[model samples]
Target: MKKILALVLALALVLSCASALAAKVGVSMPTKDLQRWNQDGEYMEKLLTEAGFEAELQYASNDVPTQLNQVETMIDDGCEVIVIAAIEGSSLGAALDKAAEKGVKVIAYDRLLMDNANVDYYATFDNFKVGVVQGEFVEKALDLANAAGPFTFEFTAGDPGDNNAGFFFNGAMSVLKKYIDEGKIVVTSGQTEFADVATPTWKTDVAQKRAEDILTANYADGKKIDAWVCSNDSTALGVTNALEDNYDVDTLGWPIITGQDCDIANTKNMIAGKQSMSVFKDTRTLAAQVVKMVGQILAGETVDVNDEETYNNNVKVVPSFLCDPVFANAENYKTILIDSGYYTEDQLQ
Candidate 1:
């Protein structure tokens, strides 16, 4: 009996030592205010912990300086790897340089870290494809391919500081510019340039105000906006709010809006027919992929990357693993969101 007890205590000691020696990984999210970021951060932390790593998760509350400081703290805490979904792509150069000096591996998560030489790999959904899907949805809904009558359209892009915002805007523009040039689509607000239509921090209220101004100035003269191609769900929600509050439902009707992130509020909007479509990137899948990459990185194995050519972070092309995105509308939200166990019906309601 004493021998058995001694063996059990020895096993416990080994387990405790293993836990103490586990490699640490830091995950920095831009904000917890957004449901998507909350999901991403939680999922990643859970997965990393399950994989036997010390996961340090931090949310920067959408502040660049705060995010930088959080990352610095992670480095100082002896994190072997740091995964960052940057608040602003270009603002992390100093923090990332410190990470490099500490010989820590940095993975740009979802948001590409710009102008930094320390970013080792990028893991995100195909942002360009996200835009393409949005653009295609608008085209098919409006019958732009069949030369439908001239329609007034507007755009609402994400923060200019986000590298993915440019990719999203450009991808959508690639599909829509031909119609604009052919005179089939007109910019009602003349806010066609990305700079003009950008939402500063993907803030819903800011987007709402900008969208309100656009509707009041352009559509107030009895003109209708056929579509508003917003980059993500937050901006889409803003446009929806402005439309419902300002414009008469009978006169202007709801424009066919496009968005990404399949956020809960936007999913509710999609069900109510207030939102046309959203691109679902599935954070669970992304978190799993990132966790796998982290495991490989920790094991000193060659990390898997499918695309080595596309994402140039101004310093070098980041090795990227691009996940596919799917579009969700009212018709399939149940299947895509609920049935898939991403969300329960009660939660959405």
Candidate 2:
């Protein structure tokens, strides 16, 4: 009877030991202003919880210092791993360094921090490829227009301070500059003509006013712009609004405008024949990969990222994973966003 009781007790102890091995993870997000980030965070939380790890999430509301403080707090809370979507790449250096010294694993989500090397893993879409697609889409759209003479245009880029923003702008401009040199597309006010081309924070009002001012000065000089290459959906929408407010979009022939992010309003606008196209980098796939990585880390299994690479200040050629980005126009609007459950028919309508 004592032997039987002892065996049962030993089994219970083993079960308790198994349960205690599961760890707590900390997730810090820069902001939830963008719909994708919010979705990504929720997906990560759900997956981590289901995998038997506790998740503590915090949002910085776009404040860099606040993100730093949150990381410090997560480290102090004895978190086994920290996932960061840093608000500003430069400001995150100090916090990441400190987290490394504590022997905590760090995963850089979406945007990689260039200044630090403490990150153990990174999962993000091919941001440079995203820009390339945006540029190529603009090129194709312009070819369809087949304008008669030189076409004047303007470019509205994202926050200049961010490295990803610069890559996006550079990639887009690389293709755009081809036409500009060939004199096929006339850039009246952009990196060449406009004095204020650097967008610091991606503020909507600032974008609107800049477009308004550009149209007032450049386009008003008897030069009708054939296209406007706004970087992302938000900026593209602002530029579209400014154009419509100032001049008749119908009369202007709705200058071929390009945008990214697959934003709800922008996707709807694409269906309604307003915007041209948007680059859709599915956040769901990205979230799933991140969850898988977290699970691997928890199980003491190695995650594979040899196919992906990025340069960090501390670690050159950091292992990373990048997914493909799709350019969604009117044709694939339903098939991509709706069919994939990213948006519903009612949502688009």
Which residue pairs in model 2 clash with each other?
A: none
Q: Which structure among the candidates has the greatest lDDT?
A: 1
TM-scores for all predictions = 0.94, 0.89
lDDT of 2 by residue, 271-339 (tens): 878888988888778877887777677667888574444545455556787778888989988898889
Candidate 1 on 54-145: residue-level lDDT in tens? 99999999999999999999999999999999999999998999999999999999999999888999999999999999999999998999
* Candidate 1: residue pairs that collide: none
Worst 10 residues of 2 by lDDT: 190-199
lDDT of each: 0.92, 0.77
Best by TM-score: 1
Candidate 1 structure, TM-score to reference: 0.94
lDDT of 2: 0.77
